[model samples]
Target: MAFKLPVHCPSCETMLSVSQLSCPECSTVVSGNYDLPLFLQLTRDEQDFIMQFILNSGSLKEMAAQMGNSYPTVRNKLDDIIGKINQLKNKNGKDDD
Candidate 1:
């Protein structure tokens, strides 16, 4: 079964950073205050939507058909995701400066 990674604290809803990662086979480990990737920073539902959109080959019309939503609805969803991605990029850019 596929598992979803936690991106925030359940109690306080604060964003989380990775402190450690380990390999199950070799037992190798790495530790640090790692920032989450841009995609992983989105909510689970958003991630799922993105996956579906990708699987549909980035065609909004195809995604609308698969999702049983209207074309405009799918377009709006894409626009929303794009906005959030831009916001994340801008935030990271500011942090890097």
Candidate 2:
């Protein structure tokens, strides 16, 4: 079974960096320090919500039905995720600058 990728350090709670990657087909390995994509840094629930939203064709009503939540609740959840993505983007932009 595949394990979830951890996004933070256990002790310090700092964001974790990807340092190595290996190919399953060939035994080739690549090593480098890298930050995960903004999306991957989000909580798993957040990721799943985004996935479900896409699967529902970006329909908030459909997502609400699928999740057994009110439409406003689903909209709030989506809005929260959008805010998080924007924050991450801004942080990355500053880091780049």
Model 1's alpha-carbon lDDT is: 0.87
lDDT (10s digit) by residue, model 2, range 1-97: 9999999999999989899999999989999998888889899999999999888899999889878999999999999999888888887674431
lDDT of 1 at 80: 96
Model 2 lDDT, full chain set: 0.90
lDDT by residue (tens digit), candidate 1, 1-97: 9887888899999878889999999999999998788889987888999999888888989988888999999899889998988898797774331
Stretch of 10 with least lDDT, candidate 2: 88-97
- Clash list (residue pairs), candidate 1: none
Runs of candidate 1 with Cα error greater than 4 angstroms are 1-3, 94-97
What's the residue-level lDDT of 55 in candidate 2? Answer: 89
lDDT (0 to 1) per candidate: 0.87, 0.90
Model 1 weakest 10-residue run by lDDT = 88-97
User: What's the count of clashing pairs in each model shown?
Assistant: 0, 0
